[model samples]
Each structure stands twice: as structure tokens, then as C-alpha cells.
Target: MSGYFVTKGSKFKGRPLTTLPVVLNQDLSRIINSNLQLKSSHDLEHLRSVAQQTDEWTKLTVRIREAAEASQSEH
Candidate 1:
């Protein structure tokens, strides 16, 4: 292993955000995205203005067999 790296805003709350891929076909994905935006009031207004919203969409996958927090550099 090399070294550990944590983002500026990340705090050691004894846990981290993670996910198990929730695959959705285009139809299902669109439903989820629309509902999220509607509920958030399309709160991500900057994203709405863009022509293509591919970046706004999360591809939904992360694969890491193991990771260790060797150390943390605090902000």
C-alpha cells in the first residue's frame, strides 16, 4: 500500500459513505433522476441549464477490494 488520502471536507465520523451498485436501465434511471430533481426543486439549478446532463448522472459503481486509513492529514 502507498498512503492514505482524505478530501478536505471529509471528517472521520468512524464511517464512510459507500454503495453497492444499484443498476438501473435507462427507463428506471430516468424515473429516479426526475424524482430526485423534482424533490430537490431541481435544486441543482446549474446542472439543469447544461445541454447534456451526463455528468449530473451517477454511473453507480465503486470497486475496491480493500483499503486502510494509514493516516489522515487534517485540514
Candidate 2:
């Protein structure tokens, strides 16, 4: 728990635990690589564009709430 903040030139119990080994070999590697390959969504809606639109709407909503609060306070 407390012994997990990574730093350079660090060793653990002896064998340099700073770098973790990723075992991507043989059939496992081929299957993983095939599955991990990027493919576009079926509906033609990209995640990045949807995310940007959601962010813009959230910001506008926050601004509208703040303006309403300010008007109430002034009255």
C-alpha cells in the first residue's frame, strides 16, 4: 500500500521492480493484438466529437447556473 510511489533508480527486494514485465508472446500476443486493433463505430459517430459536444454543453450549463445564481443574489 504505502510502498508504491515509483521513482527512478529504485530497487525492490533485489531485482529492480521499477519496470514491470508484460508477457505478450505466442498465441496470446496474436489474439491480443488482433482484438486491440482500432476500428470505427458502426453508427459513424466518433467518440472524440461526441466528447467535445458534451463538454461544450456542460460548460454552457454551468455558466447558465452561475448567471442565475448571480441574478438571485443581486435581487
Which candidate wins on TM-score? 2
Best by lDDT: 2
- lDDT tens per residue, model 1, 1-75: 011222357465865534221222222233432432212223334334432555444432110111111112221
**Judged by lDDT against the true structure, how good is candidate 2?**
0.37
Which residue segments of model 2 deviate by more than 4 Å?
Answer: 1-52
Q: Global lDDT for candidate 1?
A: 0.29
When superposed on Cα atoms, how far off is each prediction in RMSD?
16.6, 18.5
TM-score of each: 0.15, 0.31
Worst 10 residues of 1 by lDDT: 61-70
lDDT of 2 by residue, 3-70 (tens): 22234373546654332112211212233223221122321233234337988546544654665566
TM-score of 1: 0.15
